[model samples]
Target: MVIELYTYPVGFIFTFFSILSLFRLKISLTIKFGIVGNILYCLSILTSIPMMYYFTRDTPLLLLLLSRISLLIINLIYLHKLRLKKREITLEDESEIRKTILNLGTKFMRLEVREISEKCGFDRDSIIGVLKKMIINEEIYADFFQTTNTVSFDQQTNIDEIDRLMTVYKDWEKDHYEKET
Candidate 1:
């Protein structure tokens, strides 16, 4: 009785949970595949647990060929997908993503690399490294550094400066509104 309880039913439960786990968020894909592979492997151990049943010596060899082949293929495919997903830093080649990220920091004339990293969900090292490149590329600039090491964006370049820029920005907005209409 205990043996039977631990065999097909336990195997089936493992498979069921594995399938269900795919729907769960925040769990890594690698773990899901491992669960499925483990269950299929345990289930495959059933040789003759069913009374008078002969999986290996069965005359037709139906279970041996069909079940094993299908399970093996599925396991290999899932495992391969897991391996692909587990590769670190999959977005390193996508410059567009980096461009969008760069825009966040760019909005601030000057912000601490740490501040941008925290806000944008990027590491500090990556933020600073990319920021240095952006600076070199003339995509961004630091202010008030004619003789100092400080890099900061003055909130108000000048009272007059803000008013002047706001007027220009408002004019651009009106132009866009007219064009859209």
Candidate 2:
């Protein structure tokens, strides 16, 4: 009965993992899912091999082998695509942040996360999450202080200013991470 379901399981599992990997929140789950799914697929094929002798026909055996190989190839392609992908922001997220930043303006150097949340019509935690990513990736001159629950922003619009601040931030992040280990 289990052997009968082999054909559907691998394709479904690979697809599930590949789709799961598209979302950033479940990245670890996707990696584990892919690894486990592929291993299970391989094991299923190995076990299925002995059944080849039970069948009298070459065509069924050939069909089964072809299907297995096809599924493997498809999954390998999906994994490759997943590897090339970076976490992406939707248009709504980008525009929302843009509006939030515009609201923050070029003058204000700092504000509380709750303030930004109320002004931007976004949740406080998500605002912090997006700002943290912006600080790391876009070199946005912002710092999220968890203790005070405040976001400190540098009003300096100059590229050189941002670069220097980002360098300092990277050092701080490195030290922080090092201490955690």
Candidate 3:
């Protein structure tokens, strides 16, 4: 009885952490498997109630074994997904702000909106407008240097900025290229 109660909570804790780790790691397979495994493990753990009621005794070993097996299967599937080929980003799919921020980060060692516009040959006003939207969306942190009129973005900021830019750029490029060709 004591063992069954203890193992139940421990299993729950492991399942919870596994789910959180999957999200933090950004591993899509891990996230999927973890969610499925946690659900199964939770059901198996709940079965302990029936097991005790029917046998009038503890069933720790059975519950522990089932939880472990579910976790093991999830891990295997996650590893398999990692071994698959990764997709590449195409120029037509690239975001303007994201690409511009990345280039500026590399060349100037800083991701300033103004510098990104100049480096990427994009209009300053347009870039600022896009950046404002990103900031509102919580995609980027637009830190204004009031004295210098400069805005800087961190690594995640660069990624967000680029993602937004690419989305807009794709639409514009589609029309422009269609017109030219």
TM-score winner among the candidates? 2
lDDT per residue as tens, model 3, 50-156: 66647766667566656766776776676666544222223442376655654555344344556666666655555665555555776555564545646665656
- Backbone clash pairs for candidate 2 read none
User: Over the stretch 1-181, how does candidate 2's per-residue lDDT look in tens digits?
Assistant: 4854774577567758757675756654565566566556556655666666567534665666667567667756666665445334467965797667645745478888777777777655566667787778754667779898887776675345656778999999999999999
Candidate 1 on 37-78: residue-level lDDT in tens? 555544545433353254344643445536655765776676
Give the TM-score (vs. native) of candidate 3. 0.28
lDDT of each: 0.53, 0.67, 0.60
Q: Which sequence of candidate numbers ranks them by lDDT, best first?
A: 2, 3, 1
Query: Model 2 off-target regions past 4 Å?
Result: 1-90, 158-181
How many Å off is the CA of 92 in candidate 2?
0.2
Between candidates 1 and 2, name the one with more favorable lDDT: 2
- RMSD to the hidden true structure, all candidates: 11.5, 15.0, 14.7
Candidate with the larger TM-score of 2 and 3:
2
Q: What ordering of candidates by TM-score runs from best to worst?
A: 2, 1, 3
Candidate with more favorable, higher lDDT: 1 or 3: 3
